[model samples]
Structure formats: structure tokens, C-alpha cells
Target: MKQKRSRYIIGIDLGTTNSAIAYMDTRKNPTGGADAIRTFSVPQLVAEGEVKEREGLPSFLYLSTGQDLPVGSLDLAWAKERNFAVGEFARIQGAKVPGRLVSSAKSWLCHQGVDRKAPILPWGSDMEELSKCSPVDASALYMGHVRDAWNYLMAGSDPSDRFEEQDVILTVPASFDAVARELTLDAAGKAGITRITLVEEPQAAFYYWITDNEENWSGIVGPGKIILVCDIGGGTTDFTLIRVREGDAAPTPERIAVGEHLLLGGDNMDLALARLVESRILGEKENRLDSLRWLILASLCRNAKEKILSGGDVQQVGINLPGRGKGIVAGTLSDSINMEDIEQTVINGFLPDTRFDETPVRGRGSGICEWGLPFVADPVIPRHLAAFLKKHAAEQMDSSRADGRFPLRPDAIFFNGGVFTPRIIRKRISAMLSNWFSHDTDPAFQPLVLENNSPALAVARGATYYGMVRRGRGVRIVGGCARSYYVKVAENRAALEPGQITAACVIPRGMEEGEEMEIEAPEFKVL
Candidate 1:
């Protein structure tokens, strides 16, 4: 008889564009060592009739007709006869037919104005022709895939072992509100995940960095060092400011600040490229692209942008368009995304060299638009980062050091998410940031850019490290609540006025997880 596998601690990063899972066997690292961290090559269907294990599972979900695919083509170890694909195949096929693809469910998860529980994905798809899933349901499906992959990988070795029984750490965006967090928990339950601890994505990324520099984390990031975590993912760009302070035993890391959750990221870049392509293609002909055609073009531009960005030496990335009614080839309407396009749109447009005081400008309010994910109108990333720093500068640092010119400054920076995979992007941001810090007195002020390997898989790996730390093994970041929780109280006893409502902080910043707090204030009626 074979020896049964031991229980494992798993980490799941349910990202916007891609999702991943990592695990650590308790038997291998009985003491919860840092070397015990390893990720699962998620087994997913890459093609119509092919399945392969890959580093990260694409979050795109494809709703297919029951008769469209052959038997077992869409089958996984734990699922069979599924009329949908949830990984690599989903992304590839969905790009070709945009009407059936459910993308950016994570973004929709936080759209409180809209009904997240409603089955309205595949945004503008004809329901009679294509299947539909709710944003919550879509998220649950991705998590379900991760859970099933883990169980199948540990099949016969541990009959009693299951993901729901283990210590599982799931990561969410730091800016997710109460409703969104509760909905995430609900999704976990739907995915058969019984026991789980929610960790913020930015915090998870920091944990991975700490694990990477385990031996010298204390020495490297000493006391008073402010580490900025710039997490620009496929769908959103998040910033977390972690300040290291000298503890009784070792240096403790605390999440001092978290920026506003902006719907600005690689998706914006893809859309920008798509518009450029559309303009160039339409200018050559008198015909305009319909909604369906425009969606297809956007998908094509996204693929082209990725290829062009990844290919450092390559000058241009060509996109092939499907043939129209006139006599033409499928590749006739193809467009090329050149290096100049990337530098102009991404580097200059998104990551401009802006002043520390400059913030993103809100545009004039417009009439009601289509019911979709609310994205930031402005695409300037540096301005947003600067604005976030400016907001926390006065509170985080001493007023004496806070001159009018330089309000907030970070000692170190850690880049995370698939958006930072390209070296050009990393270099551009670093150079621009360093330039911002350069002043009259401090001409040589340069913030350290911490080296990170496998940016695509860092969050998932870090989440596993966080899980290990939770088990009382490695050095942990003592970060509590990133932001304070507040409750509103109406001032006027009669009619509500403009300045009637005032918010009282309940869970203050840096409040540790699992710690309870009691609000001590004047008696107020619960409305």
C-alpha cells in the first residue's frame, strides 16, 4: 500500500484576468519553513480537445452550446459534460467570439450600483444564443476550478484530504467594501470552500517578497523604511504603503495606507490600443465597425498589445481580422501595433512624469451610459500614485520632513501583477519615480526597486507564504486593517440635511485581524 499524503496549506489568488493556486505540504515542512512554498500548475483545457497544466489559469469563462463541443473535450478530473470553459481555452475561444466570453467578473463584483448577483455576464450577449452566469457565480466557478484541481492532484494519496478541510488563504483587493467582501465569502461557499481566511492582495504580494528575502528581510528593510507596493493587474491598479517599524523582537511591517480602488490598468491600455486600431482601420475604408465587430477588434488589439509588450526586440505585432462581405482574405483588415504605439500610449500617456502634488482630474459628469464596470476616465497611473502618496503624506510622516514640495516619499518599491512582467514598464516607472524624488537638497534621492522573479506568479506564491505564517512558522508582517471602518451618524434629529451625516471610525487603521473593537461614543439611535 502507498503512503498517504499529509495535509497541505493552500493559497488561492483569484485575480482579475488570471487565477492561480499554490500549496505547501505539512509533512515536508513540519515547522512551516520558507523553502516549503510551491505553486500548482493548474490543469486546464488550453484548446478544444487538449488539456495541459499551466502556471496561471486565465480568468476568462466561455459559455458554450452543449452540442458545440465533443464529449470529454471540456471535461476536467472533477467536472464532466460542462457547457463552459474556465481557463486558457476560455480566453482563446472567447477572444474569437466575444459574445460568449465572461471577462472582468472581479471588477463587476465590486460594482455596488449594479446587481452583482444577477445573471448578466457576457455583457451584451443574446441570452437565447449564449448561456449566462452572474458575476458572483463566475467568480465561484474560477474558485471551484482551483479547488477541483487541488483535489485531483492529491487523488489517491489522501482519500480524506480536501481543500475545504485545509488551512486555505484567499486574497482580495484591499479596497473591497463590506458588501463586496461578504459576496466573496458567499462565492467561496458556492465553490465548496468551507474554511478560508481572507487576505488582501497587496499584503499577499508583500508576504511573497518577505519570503523571497527571508534570510535578510530585517536587514534589508530596516526600521522607518516605507515600502510602496504598486500592484497593477489586468483589470485594476492598487497601491499599498507598508511602513517597517522596530518591534520588541524584530522589525514589524504594517499596512499604513491603501489607495482608492481605481479601475485603471492593462485593460485600459488594451482599450486604448483597440481605439487606435479602429481609427486607423476605419480611416482606410468608409465602413464603420458594428458593436460585434468592435468587440472582436478590441480582443484582437488586447492580444496584439500583450505580444508587442512582451517582445522586447520585436518592432511590431500584427493583428489579423476576419473577412467581411466583400471579397477579401481573413487577414485583410489586419493592423500592426508598433513599439512607437506602446511608448506613446502606455509610457507617455499612462506613466507620465507628473508632479507629486498632481492628481487625477475628474471629468464633467455625463448622461447615463451602458450598464458596465465603472472604470476611471483618466489613464494617468503616475498621477494616481502621486495622489495616493499625497493623501497619506501628512499622517504617515512627520510634518517637519513634509515640505511643500515633497509631501510623501517611499524608501523602497515592490512591483507586482502581470502588468509589471515587462522590463520596459518596470524601468519606465522606476525612472519616473526617481525623477520625482529628486529635489534641490536631495539630488541623489533614489528609491530602491526590490527585485522580483516571476511577477505573474508572485501573488499566489506569497499567499502560500502567508498561509504558512498563519500556521506560526516564518516571520510575519504585523499589518492590520489597511483602512479604518466607519459608521455614519445623522446630526439632525428631524430632516436630513447636506451636512447632517458624519462618519465615526469603528475599526481604526492598523487594527490587527481577529481582534475585536468596541465603539465608545454618545448614544445614537440605529436608523
Candidate 2:
């Protein structure tokens, strides 16, 4: 027998608007340990035209007629056309053909008062009509994505592949809330993932930072130090300050705590810009005609966003607003809407250019007009931007020490998020960081500890790399969360059962991580 090899650790980057998964196989490096890990990432978007109801795929499946499926990539049959809309309950929704859809259910898990499993996608209502889904039926939705990825890997397995050794580490935003984390763990379980862990997005990036020190940063943290991690992505922003240290005891680099601002991200910026286009192009006429008009609007938002990213101004917004009394709204999307209008829509209404805490910042004019409706001038949009920036600054400060603690700064942030990629956005963020650490003088505070080098894949790469570390370490104890389940030991075999303890973990909670504490299982059987 050519002994089957146990292998692979899957890392999922589940963002607000986009998501991806990367894994490592031992074949990459036999001599090196965890450092030999490799990675691959694809947008979590499923296109309708290529949908196919396969084993791991979600419903609304599409197949590319007769084409061989692209195994480790997004089925981009409809990527060229995508739009964002205010769904049924005014929630921002994106349109997808039959099986083509993208979701970041990870972000919705933290809504206050509302059930995390409730229909929370922006267009939950309208989509309910389209898919004839229940008001709160998200079970078959995003969960299907997990299945899809798992199945994708399984399908590629050879007869000699030993899946028993495969493990998974899920990267969640550092700021994930209680219910949000719960729901995500639920989703992971639903995906049939038996060995899964949730690592803060920033922390995962840190592993990458530690791995590629010298080239990416000034120096690595000497064993113990405090570090701040800021990750801005498509749908939200996550920030955390952590202490970094290495040990194989059981998932080292203790995650002190993480904080986040719900619904703050580049996607929001896109939304504001989209709305600005709608206001300028449609103006006073939006009460008429609507067939493929929705589709056209989607295209406009995508185009306008691209224009801004390209370092150029868009003159006209091509929308399909028919019968709206607005003369050129439907017919003309070419170079017609006057670049001035687009500029104001962004600069004045969407994301107003402004200053924060005496530090200057920039926002797309498109963001200004889109976010600031009835769009007033004289510090209109800038005020909103200022509030957001200030809120983040305050949150970071509040989370810095966490009750009289000099946790020590991290060697480097190990930064990786969508916002870090765009050249313009990167520069803007750099300026903001300049202001953020202007006061720290510990010589430990990294001036600008970030990894713009490999923005999106950083987290996935770190995770995949780390997975290689546990190859022969036996069954390791991944962090535990509520409503979560792991195989229980019985009959000398593992049995499936949900976690029992609800009180903020006992033994583990009471003693220092390195110190072991005896625990007596308290039972209160629910009737």
C-alpha cells in the first residue's frame, strides 16, 4: 500500500461582500514545517450561468452548458454584470442569475435583537419573492457555499488522498460580535466541517507578517509585545490589538479580544456612489418604468466604481431608467451626465473629502452625494465621513489597553483586507495611520505595521501555512464557541453533539492559558 497521506488545512476569508478559501498540501514541502504552506483564493461569488446542482454546490445551480468547470476559481459567467440594490427592507442587495450569488453571512451574525439566522441580506425580502424563500430561511443559502468549497476539494481528491488529517481555520473579522460568531460557527458546522477553527482576520494576517518579516516590516516582535490590527474590507471594518508569542501548547497567540464597527467598509462606499449616480441620473424622475432597468442600474454602479478606481472622473452614468420623465436617464449613459455632476455626486454627496482629528482624509466625491442625500453643502458629506473616522479612532483607543494592560504592541499588524489593495485607498489609509500613532513613543509601536504586499490573500496564506504546522501534532484543541459542536468521545469513537456549557467557559476561562485548571462539568439538562 502506498500509504495514504494525511494532509491539508483550509482557511476561509469570509468578508462582508466577498469570501475566499485557501489550503495547503504537504507535497509543497517535506523538509519545512508550517512555513511550507501555499495558498489560492477566488471570490466567493457563484454565477448563475455556470450553476449546477452538484454535491457541494448550493441550489440555483448553473452549469456552463458543456464546459469543464473551473475547479479552484469563481464561476464568472455573470461577473461582468453585477449591481447593488436596496433590497425588500431597504437592505443593500446584489442581483445574481439563477445559481450565481455572493454572500457574506458572516457579517450579519451580529445584529442586535434580531436573530442571526433571520433573513439579513440587504435584499432578503425581494429575494424571498424571487427564490420563493422563507422570510428567515438562510440555512440553504450561504451554508451551501461552505458545502461548495468542501465538495470542490473532495472532487479533486485522488484515491490515495487521506482527508482524515485535513483541518480548517476560519478567518472572521476581528470585530465579530457574539451572535455573529455563533452564527458563523453554525454555518461552519452545517458545511460538514468537523475540524474547523475561527481566527481573527488580523491575527491570521499576523502569522503571514511573522513569516515574511524583514522584507515586509522593520522587525518582528521579540516574543511578547502588543500590536494593533486594522482590517477594512468590502462590507465592514475590524480592529483588534493583540499580544504575539509562539508556542505549540494549543493554539498560541492568545486572542485577547477584538472590536469592530458594523456595516463599515469599501462596499458601503460603493453603495453611496451607486446612490449618488441614481440621484444625479434619475434626479426627480424615478417613479416610472422598470423591467431590465434594475439590471442596467447595476451595471452603472459597477462602471462608475471602476471609473473612480481608475484614477479618472466619470462624466455620465449609464442607467436604464425608462418612463421616468427624466429624459436622458434611460437612453444616455455615455459621456452625457456631465462629469461635473458625477464629481459632485461623489465629492459633495457620497464620501465628502474631510479632516479627522486634525488629520486630513479623502473620500470619493461619488461617496459624498450617494451617502449625503438632499445633499447639503457647507460640511455636508465631510461631517459624516468625519464621524465614521472618529468613531473608528475612538474604538481603537478604547480597545488599546483593555482595563489597565500594556499588552505590548505586535511586531507588525499582518494587514490584509480589500481596502489595502487599491493604490489610492492605501495612500489614504497611510495618512490616516500617520495620525493614529502620532503619540505612541514606546519604540515598540510600529509606525505603519501593515502588509499591502499581498492584500486579500494574506489571511488565507497565513492560515494555510499554519495548517501545515499541525500535520503530526495529533488532534489539537481548536477554540470553542457557543451552539457549536465537536465530536464527543464515546464507545472509543467520536460522537456528534452540540456544546453543553453556556456560561462563559469555566476551567479555560479561570486559569491562565499555560496553566491547567481542573473542571467539574456542571449539568442542567434542558427539559
Candidate 3:
């Protein structure tokens, strides 16, 4: 019997500690709103004792003395409760190398061979410590998640249904260089994702913001309007100047320029806070902060951070040390020195505007200088992004204002990314941008911004939108106005290695694949 083509579109947001997937609904077209981007965060993490069980059969798997019984997420979660799980619930803990565990998969994507090697952690784990698992290839590790995402979609889908044509659109940070983009696409392909288009995270966030506001991409974009997008995510923060021009077809939008800081994210902030906590509170007791323990503290500080920023002292919003049983701690944090402490933690740790043209923020190659986003900016990360964006922006924009690009500013800024949690980071982002653009002499340098519109999940949502647009299956905000050029695969190029660049292939003209136009050229292979 012949099989049918698959029609499923999978959107995945592979994050630091979590991963999620969403796609086009065969039953209902997700209204082109914030709601359209529905996803399952449970994709990357499975807690202990939470695995679904069948009524008649054994509820779990066994691998021990008598073939041990094991449940998925619940197993680890339960282990943590019972104190059986060690070093991050049986995962690696307290390793000097980020390579040991796949905590910063996206950051590793910035490297050559590393991007292909760093994404293998929860898939299989042993108590062998973090060092045994540390491999230099970040791309391979990342591929595991993409593969998992694809498998998840296939598993959840109806088996009796005929396979339908599905296209994939992957999202990544703006600072990603040619190598990173290639590696990301390669990873997607390895995971069974067929057709793909890489959209910058900030760009996807902008679409989400516009789609939410207008109900569709067509609503907000028409005639002459400027929409600036500033996406300060966990790993990287970027700014893009989008201009809606009414010259041809629909309101065509162009990406004028983009700015970002790689190392400035929530994680960066967390590290800073963690260190402070270690020095001021824990001090000599630092050794007690194991991986799992540190994770718990980071989680608590993150939870209370936003509340503290909002001028509210959290109720029961405090640290939890599993072994120590410190469930939660609270102080006169809101009214007293709490907010000040938090503010100082962020302001001082990040170095704000004062950090330009120096250290991680400056003189780095493409794709962010620091992987540490200010969200938890201690122990800084492998990538520092802001300086990368600013440098690129300076090169592309004429800050002198002599050229039309001089005013290079976005109309309305959109912020979304996996790292944009706790919501307080949004405020921190606005403050940073105020400093970034204020240094400019041009009157048009002002940027309009919005905060956390499903920050972590925006890319997955936009990917679904992009897939539909590409396949002509659903309506997207990319109505009459879209990129004038057709969505063509990169052209003839040599066989690309893990992170090598193969040229872009052009789609035949006149054949809009549900996008602006169809492939006009003969279907030629890119590899």
C-alpha cells in the first residue's frame, strides 16, 4: 500500500532548560493572534512520576535488579522528592565546563564544530558526573532536540491520516552568523524537518506582536508606518528597524537594521545574583550549592525578581534548597533594601551603556560576543550578544544621519525569546535600549517598544505562521506586502560540513509556495 505525504507543520522553541513544539491545526486555524502560538513546554523536560500510565499494563519501565520500573518526568521529579536523584535529578551537576551539560545549546551554535556537538543531556544520563558527557560539538546536541520535536509531532498525529506536505521554519538569534544558520538548518534536516526557512528571533517576535494587535499580519502593516522591534530574550537581545513601505503590492516591510547583545540575558543576571548569594549569604557554604541546588535557587530568585521589580514583596517567593529543605524564604524585601538590591544586581552586573566597545560587548565576531543574557548574568556565558548587535548596527547604519539609513530605528519594538521570563527583564531591556539609542544624534533614532508578548514562545508561533504562508495552506500577516524576492532555498554549493556554508538555492520564479510567489526556476538541488 502506498503511504500519503505528511501535512504536519512543527514549530519548536529549543530553549536553555526547556523545549516546546506547536504547529498548524488541521481542525482549527489558530486565530492569527497571540493565541495562535500554542505550544507544549513539557517537550524538553519530563518531571518524575508524571509519565502517563496505561491502566491494564505495568505503569513504568524497569532497568534494575528485576528490570527496574521507570516512569518519565515523574521518575526524576519523584526521585528529587525522595532525595534519590543526584546532581540535577540524575543529570550532571557542578561541572566546570558548560560542555558537560547542554544548558546553553544556542550559545554553542555560535562556534564552528561546537554547535554540532553540545546538545545531548536528558536523552540518556548516568551518575558519571558532568565531565564524562561534555562533547565539543554543539550542533549534534542541538540536532537531538530538533529530532525530538519532529518525533513528538509524528507521534501525536493520527496514523491513519495520509502524510501531507509540511514545511519547516526554524528560528534563531539575530547574531547568528552564516555558519550558525547553516548548522541550525542542518540540525533541523537531521531531525526529519523537510523544507525550512530560518527566521531571526526578533523578526518572529515582531510578527507575533503585530499579529496579536491586528489579528492578522495584514492589519498593522499598510502604507507608510515604522515598526521597531527590540527582542531582549534570555540568550540574546536584538533591535530591528522595520519600515512598512506602500510602494508596490501590499505594505512591504524591510529589515533596515538590527542590534543585539549576546551575553546579556536573564541567565547572566541569575549568575550575578547567585554569586552575590554565595558571597553575602552562603559564603563559605558555597560548596553546598550543587547543580540541582543551584538550579533551585536560580529558579527562586527568578520567580521573585519580577515581583520585586514591580514594587511588590512576594509572598512565599523565596529560595528552596532540596537537601536543606529550605522551601522558601522572604524578607522585608519590597519596602526595605530588597528592590534596591535587585536593581543594583541588574544595573551593576550588566554594566549597561557604559559597556559599549569593550570586553564581550565589543570586537567579537558575528553571533554575539557572550552567550550569557543579563537575565541571569553571572559567570557570564559563552556568548556576549549586545555588542555584536551594536557593532553590526553601527556598520550597517549611518549614525551620522548623513544617509537615509542614519535614522535607522524600528517603528514598534517586539520582545520575545526563551530567556525573557520573570517579566522584570522587560523593564531592564527598555532601560538598556533607552541608553543605546539616546547616544544617537538623529531625531528618528527613537524606538517604540513593548514587553514580553509570550517572550519565550514567540518563535515557535511565528514558525507555524511562516510554514502556512510558505505552503499557501493558511492566511498570515504576510498578506499583500511581503518580501519582494521569492523564498528560494540557497543555490548550488559544495557539500556542507557540520557548520559549513553551502550557497543558497533560488526557488523558481512565479511559483509562490503559498508565500509571496512560487518557485520560478526549475527545482534545482542546493547541495
- Top candidate (TM-score): 1
lDDT of 1 at 372: 63
Highest-lDDT candidate: 1
Q: Please, what is the TM-score per model?
A: 0.92, 0.61, 0.61
- Which sections of candidate 3 miss by over 4 Å? 1-6, 26-46, 52-101, 112-165, 189-192, 215-226, 258-261, 282-337, 351-407, 418-425, 428-446, 450-452, 472-527
Q: Where does model 1 exceed 4 Å of error?
A: 1-6, 157-159, 284-287, 324-332, 364-371, 488-492, 495-499, 502-505, 520-527
Clashes of each: 0, 31, 100
- Candidate 2, residues 190-260, lDDT tens digits: the string is 65554666666776776666556523322344435545566777656666555444556422344444553
Query: How do these models rank on lDDT, best leading?
Result: 1, 3, 2
Candidate 1 C-alpha lDDT tens digits along 1-527: 83333378788889889888888888767876557878789899999778899998899899987766787788876787888999999998887777788998898898867799999998877658676889999999998888888778874566567766677788898888778888998999999986788898888898888888888987888998899999999888899998898899888887888888888778777777777887787675655565556667777877777777785667787877775554322235877888899888778878877776676888731211332667786788888888898788878876756656777788889999888988888887888778888888888888899888768777878888887777677877776876677887656656766556777888887788779977778566755
Query: What TM-score does structure 3 among the candidates reach?
Result: 0.61
Cα-based RMSD of candidate 3: 9.6
Clashing pairs in 1: none
Per-residue lDDT of model 3, residues 1-527, tens digit only: 73332355556555443344556654455333345545633322223343331111100111121112243322331123221222232222212122223455555455353424443432233434333322223333344433443445444555433112344566677656666667677666554555556666666666555546654454545545555565554455555656565645556555555543344565566555655664554436424444434554554565456556554555334543434344222221111225556757765555344433344533433321222212322222222334444444554454533343223333355656544454555555555545545543543343555544565566677666666555443333332211232333464456545665543334332223344444445566555
lDDT of each: 0.81, 0.45, 0.45
Question: Model 3, poorest ten-residue lDDT window?
Answer: 54-63
lDDT for 214 in candidate 2 is: 26
lDDT of 1 at 313: 68
